[model samples]
Target: MRSFVRAGYNLRKKTGKWELKVRPDKDSMLGRGLLSEKEYHDPVRVFRKAFKEYRPEQFLEFLAEAVHFSLGPFNHAPEGNLIGPYLHLVKMIDAAWLIVERASAEK
Candidate 1:
C-alpha cells in the first residue's frame, strides 16, 4: 500500500502477488496518514524518516557498486537470491538513464 517502491521496503511481484515485509509506515498514506503537512513537504525530513526503516549503509553500497556493474558483483548484497537484487539494479539504472534524462533534461 506504500505505492510502487516505498524505498524503505522493496515491493516485488513474483507470481502476481505483492509482499510487504516491514511495517505499513504509520505516517504514510497507505499507513495511518498521520504526518503533518510540514513533514510531508520537507524532502530531507522525508528521506530521514524513510531511512529510519531502511539501511543507509546498504544504500551507500548500492551507490558505490551498482554504478560499476561492469566491474563486479556486490559481495555485500542483502541475504537472499541474487536475481532480485540484480533485477532491481537494472531497473534503477534504466530509470536514471532512460526516464529521468528524457523527462527532466537533455543529458
Candidate 2:
C-alpha cells in the first residue's frame, strides 16, 4: 500500500522550546478559519495530516521551495495582495529555522 504523508517542519527557539511552523498556504487557511486551528496548534494532528514525516532539513527544503516560487514575476498591480502571501511565507521560514536551531541545541 502506498502511504502519503503531509510533511511539515518545526523550529527551536532560544528559550529551549520547539515551535511548529506550517506552510503559509496551510497557515493562511487555518488563520482564515477555513481549516481547523487544531491542525496547526496540535503537532500530532499536523503529523497525521501531512501524511509524510519531515525533519529539519526537509522543512528547510520546503521553505526554500516556497521562496523560489514566490520571488518572481513582478506584479504591477496597485494593491500588494499578490505578494502578501510570500511575505507571510518568509516569516514562517524564519520561525521554522529558529525552532530547528533551538531543538538542535537541546539535543
- Candidate No. with top lDDT: 2
Write one digit per residue (lDDT tens) for candidate 2, span 1-107: 01111123221212213534445443465243322454334323433333233344444455555555578864453332324333334444444444455458668
Model 1 Cα shift for residue 78 (angstroms)? 9.3
Lowest summed lDDT across 10 adjacent residues in model 1 is found at: 11-20
lDDT of 1 by residue, 1-107 (tens): 12323442332211211112234345455321333444333323333444454444555454445455547765665443345344444343333232233335433
lDDT, each prediction = 0.37, 0.39
lDDT of candidate 2? 0.39
Q: What TM-score, computed on C-alpha atoms, does each candidate reach?
A: 0.27, 0.31
Candidate 1 — which pairs collide?
A: none
